[model samples]
Target: MDPQDGYDWQPQQTGYVPPQHRPRAQVPRVDAGRLWAGGAMTALVAALTAVVGLLLIRGVLGIPVFAPEGDGAMGDASTGVLAMGAAFAALVATALLHLLMLATPQPGTFFVWIVTLATAVMVLLPFTTSAPLDARIGSAALYLVIGIAIGSLLSAAGRSATRQDF
Candidate 1:
């Protein structure tokens, strides 16, 4: 017989042997009570995000869903539909974010700041296309700020909620 075969594979001493592969314990479930308010907030935020996304899609696509009474520099069926869609999406996102926040705790001030920025962008999207060349730049800036604001706030809330130990 080979020398290796005669020897035992297991360790000779076993006072305190650690497992080579330890399974991770399951995370504790968050209580429904704890999540109620945050869940609502998260839902709102998600709705807002969706709304903004829809508006952007409509604006670029020029979907003629609605027919304005008369043509105007500011108003058009396609434009209106697009803008409305955007606003709605944002609201939806707002709901989503609200729900997310309900689960997690985070910095409220910073969160709101982001929401304001994204909302501002969506709010001024109509102005974005109709403005003079110089004004267009400003509109773009506004949209950027608003988008960032919304994104930041939503992410912050979500992070906080998810991070909860419970």
Candidate 2:
């Protein structure tokens, strides 16, 4: 038999063995409980802010809380509306965080971009709609405040909730 035929293809038994491939770092798992808690807190705060701001604008500043079409007053932007909107925003935000955590390597970074863009869209709604100038400004301010509160809180919550220990 030839010498080459008897040789094996296994790695050589040299004392200085080359290093094996290093496993990739583990991705952190997101804690949904903490995230949802933040969402709940944000929803409460945003809803409160909306109601208080609406009162200040309409009650204090004498700005009627009217529809975007410059129609009659909006019945004080009722608590039901504000609470439901805030809760809905929070839910949507939480869902988005869950998606990013599962599918994206950089969930926090993407989360910020997503929240910011959505807030910007919200901020622009009054201007594009048929709302009056004063009403538009007031509504836009409320939207800005609510968006900032929700976005910042949720993003922070998402960042803090992720861990490698899973």
Candidate 3:
């Protein structure tokens, strides 16, 4: 019998073993109660921001915004509309942030980008109107302040609502 064909032959074994794959990163969980609470706070802040901004522009500075100069400090019904609009915007932003948190990997980053772009649009929108330059500028400034308040406050709310999964 040939030695190569002999059944007594034993196979060589190596002690080295392949490493196991590392565990995947965990996704974050969102707390709806906390998020909505924070959103409500943000909405209140945004409404106040609109009211105060309008007062500062129309009442203190005596610049006509969202109405004629004859409309006085409060600038007519437009001021109320602006306040309601701001509150509504804040609620919409909250919904967007909530959706982003649930669907995206980097929710905060995306939220900031989205809000920033929306703010830019709002700030630029007044300039397109046929109103006087001062009115346009004042309105734009008011929109800017409102946008900032909403974006910053909602961002904080989103952060507070996120919980990291182990």
Worst 10 residues of 1 by lDDT: 64-73
Off by over 4 Å in 2: 1-24, 66-77
TM for candidate 3 is: 0.84
Better of 2 and 3 by TM-score: 3
Can you give the TM-score per candidate against the true fold? 0.34, 0.77, 0.84
Model 3 weakest 10-residue run by lDDT = 13-22
- Writing each residue's lDDT as its tens digit, candidate 3 over 1-166 gives 2254443422245443223223556768999999999999999999999999988998999998888889988878898898999999999999999999999978999999999999999989989989899989998999899999999998999999988885
lDDT of 2 by residue, 1-166 (tens): 2254443333355343223423456778888898888878878887777777776777666665543333223343464587579768977898898889889978889988888888889888889977668878887888888888888888888888888861
Q: How would the candidate models be sorted by lDDT, starting from the highest? A: 3, 2, 1
RMSD of 3: 8.0
**Which of the predicted structures, 1 or 3, would earn the higher lDDT when compared with the native?**
3
Any idea what lDDT model 1 has? 0.46
Best-fitting candidate, scored by TM-score: 3
lDDT of 1 by residue, 75-115 (tens): 35544453444445455555655554555444354456656
